[model samples]
Target: MTLTPQDRTIVEATQAGLPLVTRPFAVVAESLGLSEAELIDRLKQLKAQGVIRRIGAAPNHYRLGMTANGMTVWDVDDAVVDSLGEKVGALPFVTHCYRRPRALPDWPYNLFAMVHGETREEVIAKRVEISSLLGKACRAGDILFSTRILKKTGMRLRGKEG
Candidate 1:
């Protein structure tokens, strides 16, 4: 979605984070020189137009003792990936799971799963459990452990509106 000048500014400001206060939106409004109601209305309009999906926290899982986050890639039967993907996605430890095209000549993994744990051992165990959950439909996969935290945020105003 194309952003209005106001929308662009608000989104950029909040991308860093919401203010820590009882009235975070009011702080945003003050910084933008807009009334709280006006700021909220613009946000509402953005949501209605599907420019913004959801406003939520990008929790620091590592700092919260979840130091190991494994990006588990899977090779699964296309027919059953969807139903099983939903089950995997619903897992609290599995922060994300989605199907992508089978990796090309250089890439082999297609189904992606994200599982967070307190240690590498725990993360691997989670993957083993996932494998059992998938049963025969799951062929093979690999686990990539996260070592550092990059920036995380909500929707971007620049591209890929969703």
Candidate 2:
């Protein structure tokens, strides 16, 4: 996509993250020497053009007492995976859930969900809850916890803007 100079300015200014304030857009606009309305309108236009998918905050769950994080993998029937995935994704404790291709003969898990807790036991309890929800559809499941914390960063738009 050919991004206008203003679009590039907006993306560069807010790509790091929106300001933590009552009027973040206004602050951003001031930085670019643009009006608040102009900044908001440009954002709406960007969304309409599909240049940006969505904007939201990603909180650090570990710092919030959720030290134990695990990605629970499930081997479910392909026929019912879509419905099952939707149900799992809607779960409050499930931060993220999605379907993935299974590598048979060696690996077989096709469904994945990420859940967090303060300890491994808590994460296991949450896994049990997920298993119960999956019921017989859950052919097999396992949780993979991280030994070290991972940093999450936003995507970067490379190259100079048009």
Report every candidate's CA lDDT: 0.84, 0.91
- Write candidate 2's Cα lDDT for 1-162 as tens digits: 899988988988888799899999999999999999999999999999999877888788867999899999999989999999999999999988999999986789999999999999999999999999999988999999978865577787565648
TM-score of each: 0.83, 0.84
Model 2: C-alpha RMSD to truth?
Answer: 2.5
Q: What TM-score does prediction 1 earn?
A: 0.83
Clashing pairs for predicted structure model 1, backbone only: none
Candidate number with greatest lDDT: 2
Model 2 residue 58 lDDT score: 78
TM-score of 2: 0.84
